[model samples]
Target chain A: MSEHGTTLNIEKFGSASEAKALSAEADDWTLIIRPQTGWFDLHLADLWRYRDLVTMFVRRDFVSFYKQTVLGPLWFVLQPLLTTLTFTIIFGNLAKISTDGLPKILFYMSGITAWNYFGECLTKTSDTFNANASIFGKVYFPRLSVPISIVISNLIKFAIQFGLFLVFYFYFLFRGSNIQPNSMLLMLPVLLLLMAGLGLGSGIIVSSLTTRYRDLRFLVQFGTQLLMYSTPVIFPLSSIPEQYRWIMIANPMTPLIETFRYAFLGTGTVSWGMLGYSAVATLVIMTVGILLFNRVEKTFMDTV
Target chain B: MSETVIQVRDLSKRYRLGVIGGRRLVDDINSSMARLLGRQDPLAKVDLLPGADKQKAARSDEMWALQNVSFDVEKGAVIGIIGRNGAGKSTLLKILSRVTAPTTGEVRVKGRIASLLEVGTGFHPELTGRENVFLNGAIYGMTKAEIRDRFDEIVEFSGFEKYIDTPVKRYSSGMWVRLAFAVAAHLDPEILIVDEVLAVGDAAFQERCLGKMEKVAGDGRTVLLVSHNMSTIQQICKECIMLKNGSIHKVGAPGSVVSEYLSETRVATNVDLTQWQDRTGNGFAKLSRMAFLNADGEEAGIFPIGTTICFDLETTYNRELIDPLFEVIIHDPAGEPLMHLRSEHDGLRIGKVNGRTSVRARVDNVGLYPGRYFVSARIAAGGRNVDFPRLCGSFQVTPSPGRHGDLRLNPKWGKYHLDSTWTRGDQ
Candidate 1:
C-alpha cells in the first residue's frame, strides 16, 4: 500500500534531542488554546482574518432571502412601504398623532425606513446563537461573524428602503411643501452607523444571555416593539412633554430617528449633544456586548 | 530533525450532567453575583468550599469528558485516535478543533490548522453548489481568493460541474456529501484535524478521500484522525492513541495499539448484553447474554480452526415474536465482517418465541483464520430489526492442522482457509 511507503519516511524522525530542542522555543507556537481568556480579549485580529467568512455569510443571507420568490428584492421596498402605510393610516390619520408639520406619509415613511433597519438588525442578531446552533456546534469561526453579517445584510435592505423614501422625499420637495432639507443631511452616514452599532450591541447582549436564559428569546420579540414606541419613530420627539424628554432621549435610538427626520424632512428636533450621547451609548453597549459575547462564546457549546 | 506541531498538555474538559437548562436562573444570578463580590459560589459543592467537609461532594451533576490527557504530535505525523463510544474521542477532536473549550489545561499548536469535525458544516440548502463551495470553504478558514483560485479544481473533484449552479437542496444526499467533502478535501491547512468524516458517501468517494488525506500527509503536513474503523486506522496512521474512559489507554505503533484495543474489547463469555447501551433497533426484543461455546457445549474463549463453534444468544422479548430471524456475523480483527450467518439464509427460521429464548447458531468445520474475531448479534421479526448489538462478543481462533496436514496456517494468505484437492491436470 502507498501508506507503507509514507510510513517509512515518518519513522526516520527518531531523534528525540532535535524535537526537544525545537519544543523549547515555545514562543514559536502560533496558537495557544486554553480554557479561559481575559474578559476583554476580543480576538479582533482573528475576526479580521475571518472577514471573508463574514462576507460569505452576508451573501448567503442576501441571496437566499429572495430565491424562488415572485417579488424577490421588491419585497425590500414593499415591506417598509406597507408598514409606513399602516402607520400613516392608524397613527397619523386615525389616531391624529402629529407629524411635526411634515406630510403624514413622508413623516411616517421616514421613521419606518430608519426603524426597520434597526429593528431588523436587532431581531436577527438577537437570535444568532439559536438560529445557528447547527453550524456553530460543528465548526469554529468567530461567532461574532454571524451577527456582524446580519447587520451588514440588513444594511442592503435598509438602502433599498431608503431609496423608496427618497422618491417621495423629492416628490414632496418638488411640490413646494413647507419642509426644508438642510446641512444636517451630512450626518446621514454617521446616523446609520450609530443605528447599526446600537442594534448590533443590544442584539448580541440578548443572544449571549439567551444561550442560558431562553426566556429572552421570547422577550426580544416584544422588546423591540416596546423599544420602538420609546424612540421617536411614529411621533416627533417634540410631542413629548418637557419633563419626559429625558426618558425618550435615554432610549439611545431616539436621536438617530430624530436626526434622520430632521436631516431629510427638516422637521424633528436634532441636537449635537443628544447625538453625541447616542454615539457614546452605542460605543459603551458595544463594548459590553462584545466582552460578554467573547466570554460566553468559549463555553456556550456546553450550555447552549 | 522533527518539530512538534501540536503539543497538548494536561487537557481536561468537564461537562455538567443533567438537562442543560435545568439550573434555575436564580442560581445563576446568585453565582455571578457571588463571583463579582469575590465570594465563594453559593452553589459550589461543599468539597470545594474551604472549611467544609473533606469528603468529596456528590457532584453527580458533573462529568469529566476528558481528564488530564497529554500527548505531542510531530510535524507531518499522521495520528489516529480510536476509542469506543463515550471514550472521549470526539471530545479530544472538538478541543483540538476549537469547537469547544477545555475545562483546564492547554494545547499549543503551530502552523495553520483546519478541522473537519463533520462534513457540510455550514452548507445552506438554498444556495447553489457553487455558492456553497465558497461558503463552506470560508467556513473551513479558506479565503474567498483561495476558493476562487481552486474553484474549478473543487468542482472537478466533486464531479458536479454540471450541477454547480443548481441549488444544493435539489441534489441527492450522496451528491451533497460529495460536494461538501470536495470542499473539505481542498483545504490546504498545515495541520488537518478530521473526525470520522471518511465514513460518508460511497466506497469510491471514501477511497478518494483517503487518497487525498494520504497526499496531504505526504506533503509534510500533520493530520489527526479519529475513527472507529480499525482497518482505516491501521492503514492510515503511523502512530495510534487509544482512549478508554476519557484517558489514554495506549500510545504506540498502529498495529500493537489496535490489537491491544481489540483484545480488551473481547467481552468475557456469557457477558450481560442487556446492559449494553450502545445498540440500535426497535427494542421489541433484546439480547441479554452472548456466549461462545465449543463442541462440548461449554463456554469457551478459544476455538481451534476446523471445529464446531456455536454462538449462544439469550434474548428476552416484550411480546410474542412471529417468525423471528437471528443473525451472527463474525468480524475479523480489523472489524470487517468476515462471515455472516443468518437464520433465514440457513432456512432455520423460528415459528414463534415467547418471553425468554435461547438461540444457537452452530457451524461445523469452521475455516476462519487464526486470529481474534468479534461477533455481532441481531434479532429481527415482522420485516424489521428487533435488536442489533454490534461487536457484542468476541473469541479467539487458533490455527490447527488442515486437511492437507499443514501445522501452521499463515494468516497473510487470507481471512479463511479452504480444503481443496490438487491433482495433476492435463494442460
Candidate 2:
C-alpha cells in the first residue's frame, strides 16, 4: 500500500496538471483542420510549451556528436584550427587574397568560425525531414523543434571555434600585434542572428522541397560550398572590385561575414544600411522558409 | 454521466498506393505552383492532397484508406477498435492521436491525449534506461517535474533498478519492452490511445500493464485501444468498433464485436496457421499442426460413436521447454464448448522437450454424441498458453453400432453419453 501510495499517487505524480489542461474550458474547444487557408500557421505557443523537448533534442545531438570517436571533444578545437591553417596556406599564400591588412591566419579563422555555424545549420536542417522520418512517423512533436535544435546544437560547435579564435587573438595581442577589436564587436550577436536566420530559413526550404524532390539534397551540399566563395570568407569585402561589390553584397551572407570581421579585426566594412538590408532579406526568407516547413512537416513522412 | 471527450466528425484519410510516394520534381513544382495560384491541386485529384497522405487515396494510383468515418467517445470510456490489416484501424488511431491529420472533417478532443502506438517509439539505444525514461516521458508530453516525481515508480515497475544507468542497447528485447511499457503506462495520460504496443511483453507484464490501463480508465479517463487480441479487448474495453475495408462495419458491446471478428476469420482455417496474427504466448514453443483422429490414432475428419476420440498436436520449440502442456478444446456446432483437455491435467508428463514432438490426447469410446464439432489446440509452459490457434480445425461425429446395438446419437440428446443397465427392479 505504501509503495502504491508513493508511486501511483495522482496528485504527487503531477500528471494532474496535464489532466487539468483538459478540464480547462480552453482545452475542450473544437479545432477545425483543413487545407491551410494562408501560407503561415506557425504554432509558436505550442513550440514554447515544448521548450523542454527542444532542450532534449539539443542535448541528444551534442552528446551523441562524438560518442565513439577517440579524440572526442578535442576534435571540436582541432577541426577549425586545421581548416584555418589550410585556408592560410592555400588562400592566403597561393592565391594571395587580401585580408584588408589583418593577419591572414586570424582573418581566415574568424571567417571559418562564422561560416561554419551557418553551413552546419544549413546541412543539418536540410536533412531534418529525411533523417527524422522514423521519429516523426510515430510521434507528435512540434516539427519545428527539430530544426531549432539543429541550429542550437551547431552553435555549441561554433562557440568552441570562436573560443579558439579568441585564444589566438589574445596571443597576437599580447605579443604586440597592431590589431585592436573595435566597438563594432558589440554587433557580433546581430551578425550571428543574421547567419542563423539565413541558414535556418534556406535549410528548411531546401528540406521541405527535398521531401518530394530529393535532388535538392545534393544541391544543398554543392550549393553551400559555392555560396562560400561568393561570400568574403577568405577576402575582405573591400578587396572585391567596386563594380562587383553589388553582386557580393547581394548574397545576404556577404554583409554578415564583413560585419563579423569588422567587429573582431576592426578593418572590414560595417554599415547601418548594409546590415539593415541583410536583416530584412533574412526575415523575408525565414518567413517563406517557415511556411514551406510548416506545410511539408505534416505529411513529409509519406514521401521522405 | 461522463462528458464526450472525443467527437470525430466525418474524418477521412487518403493515401496513394505503391512506391511513387516520393513525387518527381516536375509534379511537385506543378503542385506547388497550383497552390500558389489558389487552385485545387491537380495531383491531389490523383494523389495525396498535401496533408492527406495518411490512408485511403482513391484515384488513378490512389485509394481511400478511410472514408467519412465518424465516432464519439465519452470520458471514462474504454473503447476498442478491431479490424483486419488495411482496415484503417491504425489510420483512425493516428488521426485521433494527432500523429496524422485527417484529409477532411474535424475531431475535437477535450483532453490531453497520449498515444502509445509502439512501445519503444522513440527510445534511443545509446541512452541509459534512466535517461530514456525522461526522454520518453517528455515525448509523451509529460513535464520534467512529473517525470522526476514518477521516476522511482517507473524503475520499480520495470524491475530494472540495477540496470537503470546502463545503456538500453545492452538489454534484451523483453527487458527493453518492459521498461518502455512501464514508462508509457505511468505518463498520466487523460486520454490514452494504445495500438497493439502492449502485445510485445510477456503475459505477466502485459497483464500488469493492462491492469494499470484499467485503473486509469476507472479514474474516469478515456481510453481508445486497438488490438488483434480479442480477449484483451474483451478484458478491458466495454465497447468495440469493428472496421472492415476502411469503414465502420459494426460498433457494439465487446462480446458481439469480438465474436463477429472471430467468425470472419473462421473461413481461413483450411490453410496452415503458422503465419496467423492473433495469438498470445511467450513463444518458447509453438503448435505446428492440429488434427482430429479416430481409434487408430491416424488423422481423420469423422469419428464414429463408441470409437476413440483423439487429436494429434504437433509441437515445435525454438528452444527447449520444460513441462509444456498441450491441450485441445471441442466445441459443438452451436458454438457451445463440449470439452476442454490438457495433457498436464491428464497427468501426461512432457519433460525437457526440444524440437518436433507430436502428442495425442484421446478418450476411449467417444463420449460425445454424434454431430459436428470444432477443435482448438495450444501448448503452454510456465503458466501461460503459447500457441493458441483460435479455431484449430473442425471434424464430424457420426453414430455407429455400440453394445446397445446401432444406437444413433445427435444434438437432440444431451452432449454426453453414459453407459447404463436396465434390470428387473421393484418400484
Which candidate leads the pack in DockQ? 1
TM-score of each model, paired residue for residue: 0.88, 0.74
lDDT of 1 by residue, A39-117 (tens): 9778899999999999999999999999957899999999888888899999988999999999999998999899999
Return the TM-score for candidate 1, rounded to 2 decimals. Answer: 0.88
Best by lDDT: 1
Expressed as tens digits, the lDDT of each residue in A1-304 for candidate 2 is 1111112111111133544454474454544344232566777777887888788778777766676577877898999899999999998999898888888888998899999999989988999988888778787878988899899998888988899999998888788776878888888888888999999999999998888777678888899999999999988889989999999999899889988877877888878889999999999999999999988876665553
Q: Over 4 Å off in model 2, which ranges?
A: A1-27, A30-38, B18-20, B26-58, B269-427
* lDDT measured at residue B172 in model 1 versus the true structure, 0 to 100: 96
Q: Could you give candidate 1's per-residue lDDT for residues B1-427 as a string of tens digits?
A: 6788898887877787543763556778898999999999988754343432222213655666777778889899999999777888988988898878898889999999999888988898999999999999999889999999999999998997899999999999999999999899899899999888667665577778888998999999999999876767877899998887677777889999988887776547677898887689998899999898899999887889899899898999998999899999998755668799998988886788889999889999888877778789999898898999998788888778776677566553466877777888996
Per TM-score, the best of the predicted structures is 1
Q: After superposition, how far is residue B146 of candidate 2 from its true place, in Å?
A: 1.8
RMSD of each: 5.8, 12.4
Model 1, position B414: C-alpha lDDT score = 60
On a 0 to 100 scale, what is the lDDT of residue B85 in model 2? 75
